[model samples]
Target chain A: MTDFKVKGKVWLITDNNGELINDIDTDQIFHNQFLHITEISEMGEHTFGNLEGWENFPEKCNPGDIVFAGSNFGAGSSRQQAVDCFEALGIKAIVAESYGAIYKRNAINSGFPILIFQQINNFVKDDAIKNLDEIEIDFLAGELKNISSGKIFKINPFSKVQKDIMEKGSLLTI
Target chain B: MPGKTVIEKIFTNHSKEDISPGKIVWIDLDVVTARDFGGPNVVKNFHKNYEGQSVFDQSKVFFTFDLTVPPKTIQYANNQMICRKFAKEKGVKVFDIDKGIGTHTLIENGLVPSGSIVVGTDSHMNILGAVNSFGQGMGDVDIAFGFRYGRTWFEVPETVKVKIKGNSSYDYSAKDLVIKALSILRTDKILGKAVEFYGDPIEKLDLPERITFLSMITEMGGIVGFIPFNNNTENEIKKMSGLDNIVPEIKADGDASYSEIIDLDISDIESMVSAPPYPHNGMKVSDLEKVNVDFGFVGSCTNGRIEDILKVWTILKGKKIKEGVQLSIVPATIEVYKQAFEKGILKDLLDAGAIIANPGCGGCAQGHIGMTGKGEVMVSTGNRNFPGKQGDGFNYLTSPEVVAFSVLNGFISDREF
Candidate 1:
């Protein structure tokens, strides 16, 4: 197994109080209104369009940025657009407390990175990212380190299949 | 050896090995399904990945033109065309245009059987567990792979054994029972879990009633819901499929281990509703009487069966909808529509001023017809009530009877037996 490393700006997905939002369904991640938009390149602008705090994510987001979310990150509806939007927005990886079963599979098959870490929401909630200059993630090592805060959070290791898919591009390719 | 849950037995049966929760198995699929929105995506993946590869078994693939049936827009039409072309080229049966929904069409045509491991590209495939089959939703990419390889991977989920007692009245439907289950289980509690319904309460429900009950299991965060195999279940399967006899029943061991046991009573569940924003926000209908309903919908894969529509037709036989209230009746598939139409049930609904829609997943996912405008509130029989799910409006989930009564009263109203 190889440890995948990524360093990127941290994007916190939370409410105004900075508490992580739970049960973020796929429609909230990417509204069904844009289902007509087939081209993924045009999907970034609609990412989080229905979500309150992240409506302007298209212009505000940068490629390779990491997103932090609460439990059931991609719950409800098996629309691939939810994970596809993140990939379109160039999201390097999504570290949530948990994910919907279908979303987890869609992410893995698409070779999108999704990591799980209990208490990840606590670290990202309530201005936890204010002091962090950069977030570094080591998939195999199961360590999430904040450069500025010098804080290290332990993430759960991925299953063999998950790690293999992420490395092999997609399940089809594998 | 100890007994196994229905899901465990399924995995073991397919792999010919002992299987348990937390185990990953590459089980061969008994049936693979895809609908309009997901079908186009699967077609895209099929072409991209398996250009020269022949389908594993074309007859095993099921494609239905739902979500955008009748072609709501040009893009949707093109997508449906893609699915149609794929089905034609691969010799897969396509339930093209107004076939109701995929699962309904599949079931109504008798394509599925007990003990089968069914997977679809849409999440609502969990509804198939009503017949003791293990039905789960997969993404388009995985479904495409299943079409090529006739196998897909699954991490066997833990079993949540639910035992139900008490008999339900006419007004208090299986929909209420499911909504009550959602209230108790919550959306995240049953994640990646297979829910097995047991006891007399489950045994009493008919096939249509069972479909309506298990259809919303996904909304409760469950991967699938089962009512085990019984003679009644087999008879219902036979009636729908026109099959004289099914292979055999697949029953769990008497000592099957369950991760959790929930005791639910059917008599205790009233006409419950899931308020706006989430399906878990369930409350009894009497508490929501103050909320005026602008529209009412009585169809979807969840509640669009013949029995559900007949219930609505029974109530609205000699009545008209309240002034200014719009009620739309959507059947699950062409067969359901034809049955209802032949029996004059559709006429009764139409006479009651209901706007009968084409057989499809209209308004269930916020597209096609029956969408609500800003600030509009609708009492619908569809699954899920997420914001912007059916346009900028508030949605309350309920049974067909409550929807009919709400249409007559122009507000969320409870029904009497």
Candidate 2:
């Protein structure tokens, strides 16, 4: 029931929190061109959210958008519900510098495309509002290209099998 | 030639042919466990994907609803409902709610045999390695594949032989020793390796203490951890499981191959504590200076055993917890609670100002019960002090003895006793 095609602009999320989520920081360090750095409110059940005046994220993100963040973005308790909620809200790919071990495994098994990039925070900042047209991800090249800005970021691409699963939407379909 | 170790010997004996690291060979599974938290997902995925009429083997599948049961329990009941439905539909063997023993205890009691390779969806599934079984936590996809095909692939891990020699004083428990060991050897050192605990000091500890030691091995990121089965272990297994005359393989051959061997003389190991942000960042209690504490938690699979409770009781006897320090004690299982009650340890803990919680992984999971407030400092007996792990606070990982002493002293204490 989930869509597999990667479309739309990439917005990178940075790890402004300054710690590893699951010992990996793929979101913050790896896919910065497609990253969006937003101030997350530590409110309710969610760990990170928009700072003041930016709570409407569901409207901000569209289909085929990519998200990047700091280390341990999805760290803490093993609740797949968070992933389910994110998927429902239209997140396509998640690239981070690191992730919680269990969270990384859970996200992959659930059919999300996660790329681990080392040293992501150094390239991107939380204040930048990335335009969607500037980003392109080449799975084979292990890179995320910024077409508008002409910036290319290196990445560790998914394995062939993992790519196949992502293309098919989720492992559930495969 | 590589040196032989206990893990290598066991793997070779069980392997169908000569094997090496990264080789994927099909072997018999000794045990498979499913908990309510993620078991239903595995079953659902298996039924949807697997083209089969029946399970691979009924005996190998062990089910229990530990964390989330119902209103009487700590967390929600939805996960348990799904698990119960799946068990009924498949006619799977399961342990009931009140009768449900902890997965680690149940496996050790008899559901899992010795010299077996076990996998579960729960991350802490490595707890089963206490009885010399090779156990690891897998994702739901892996479980579905395992259920459908009755086999799962694994890269044979290089083995690490940890030889412990000499005896420790009665006050020093395995909990203290493991914290000390992890402090010396960070989680990265044992990554993708199997750590086999052996030697004279291992024999000196009782089954509960041994289980406590093996329970936290996953904190070091080891693939699997274990201790060889012996007569003493067999007797304890029989006593709990009511199985008679069951003897398992004891010691591996002297020439067993191993990737590395590390020897330790821990007879003089004092109590240790792993401070916040990392489990391997440990320090001797004697070296730590006193710091203000807001919370003290004494429970979790790591330290909720009866012996741990007795130790806490010894420290809390005839004294109340320091004012403003909130202490919560969660028994690992109902059986453990009953044992504590039988020995009057429960009353002592309650009288000493500790709130008693039901048997399950509470505060440890940070879902409900004893979540740390922002900027609060807590001393706990749980494993893993990673950021936001025990709530938005600084969590210090230590033994039950240290937790008790901290509760009494109102700060991090360096006292030997």
Candidate 3:
């Protein structure tokens, strides 16, 4: 079990189909500890497999790194398994414009952090950007700062308890 | 401050001092329930973290294994085993195996007291409020905490008083009333709020009918929907529980504060329908033109009571369901199923071409039998009609009468008394 830290170049995905299947390369974000995005798709076996692809994409990826995706991500299935699989893969937080209600609750209850951001799809580049550098998350301030690119993004702040759970690790620990 | 509805009175009376919505109240938990699906995780977490002896009063804690029993997966089986072990080790006496009913139903028929605050690990636990209890669904962590400490915090909710007045024809029932309410409130209006049903008409409903009404509060995003305990409630408790001394704390003085109130006259209510994709998209039965249904179901925690079964039976007594429409019925509990069997309601439904299944929430969640096909339209009495909820198809919600009549006429029909 490795602790996750965001300390590499950023790679943002802007595909409407935010699936990390063979077509989309997560190598940049996974290898460099960067952020990525794509549109939400229906949750299915194929999608579950694609999520597992994160294992090969990131170098030292662990649960706790933030993922910035597009609107309506995680929009299907009341099954907690989908969210659990992501947690198992070491993706700590998911920042999207919107989420399906059931998925949001499941993510929260499972101790995964989710943040909603507006125009997030347009803020980062679609392709991999080297030297994108480390991003600092000031959870209380609800601000994300990119050290290399000198870019900053605003994220919706979570409640104090929610922040504690995210920072201290899973609800199992809390 | 006077002349408040019964629900309003009770909520205000029991509310923690200076507490309001969006803020945690930290009130005493009168009851805490858990089941197989999430119960093991909660107990495991509790044992691992808390070294205290029993936190809450043992008499107030309830546990059951309904959802994951006959375990759906190996993981589910393992979880149930852990839960059973924990329950035994913790000295919790209410653990029931195959004979156990669903948690909400069990609580209703067992130990839940009126005017008490209740929390459960399952989302549908809110359904327990039909007996005038205030219930809410909490995450596993909160539930574990409650297990470790007899009390938990809450953000006292503003009350939404719904007064249902007037008598309804045989075709309309409380299920229709709630379906209409859900259609009007959508899914967001009642989030984290309490809905109280009152009026002389509401008093006339039986326990099962009232349970059907209260069970759908979650559909409107409410924490719970309740009615003040009355003689009817006491009598039902006596009959079901065989306990004569269970007196419920009904409500507080009438002069209480309420956030909002809505009056509904059911005398003029006709058979109603909630179309696919949303429960709030409601229309009159007469307005359902060009809408064809391939499947029809009359069961769920919301509409699976004996009274609901009788209503469906009354509609299908001398009629047969339309050709090409697959109809199914599932009673909510074993006791209800036995009651229907003894009363010949199940035979009537079965003889009329309806498939009878065991008493549980099966097809309602689209997990078990009666899954709809692509583009198939189903008329159901279950709560919630979100897209692909009853399978990858369209589902419309309505009263049991409407479901029965639609099964008979091959299309949505107004229930004839």
> In DockQ terms, which candidate is top?
1
Best-to-worst ranking by lDDT: 1, 2, 3
Model 2 per-residue lDDT at B20 = 66
| Cα distance off (Å), candidate 3, residue B58 | 4.4
lDDT of each: 0.82, 0.64, 0.62
Per-residue lDDT tens digits for candidate 1, residues B1-417, read 789988888788777545888877789888988877777878888888889777888888888777877876788889888888888888888888857788878777777777788888788887777767778787777888888888877888899888887766545678888888788788767877888888876666788888988888877778888886655778888887676777677777899888989887657677889998989899998776488889999888889888899989888998989999999888888888888989977777888899988888886855567778999999999987898888788999998989988998888887532
Cα misplacement distance, residue B226 of candidate 1 (Å): 1.0
Worst 10 contiguous positions by lDDT, candidate 1 chain B: B164-173
Candidate 2 residue lDDT tens string, A1-174? 433335447655323453223342121111111111111121112212322222355567676677766454543333444354456556677777755554565666667777767666665642222535546666656787666677777888776555656667555555
Going through the candidates in order, what fraction of the true interface contacts does each contain?
0.47, 0.07, 0.05
lDDT of candidate 3 at residue B369, scale 0 to 100 = 51
Off by over 4 Å in 1: A1-3, A125-133, B166-171, B229-231, B265-267
True contacts kept of 2: 0.07
The best candidate by TM-score is 1
For candidate 1, the per-residue lDDT at B129 reads 79
Order candidates by TM-score, high to low: 1, 2, 3
For model 1, the TM-score of its B chain against the native B chain is 0.95
* lDDT: worst 10-residue window of model 3 chain B: B1-10
Candidate 3 local lDDT, B1-417, one digit each (tens) = 245545444555555555444554457777787766557657766787775567466776767655533555666667777767777777775455443346446554666656666777655666667666666666456677777776654545667777877766545677777766666665545555777777876666677777777777766656677776656777885666555666555663466566778776656556788886666677778777756778888877678777788888888876778889888887777777888889977677877899987666665543445668888888898776654456767888888888887778777776542
Question: In model 1, what are the clashing residue pairs, if there are any?
Answer: B99-B333, B100-B332, B100-B333
Which portions of model 3 show Cα errors greater than 4 Å? A1-86, A89-91, A94-111, A114-137, A142-156, A163-174, B1-18, B43-58, B72-76, B93-97, B161-171, B197-204, B228-234, B237-243, B246-269, B415-417
What is the per-residue lDDT of model 2 for residues B276-384, given as tens digits with 9 covering 90 to 100? 7777788777777777788898877678777788888888988888898988987777778888888877777888999987777765653446667888889998887
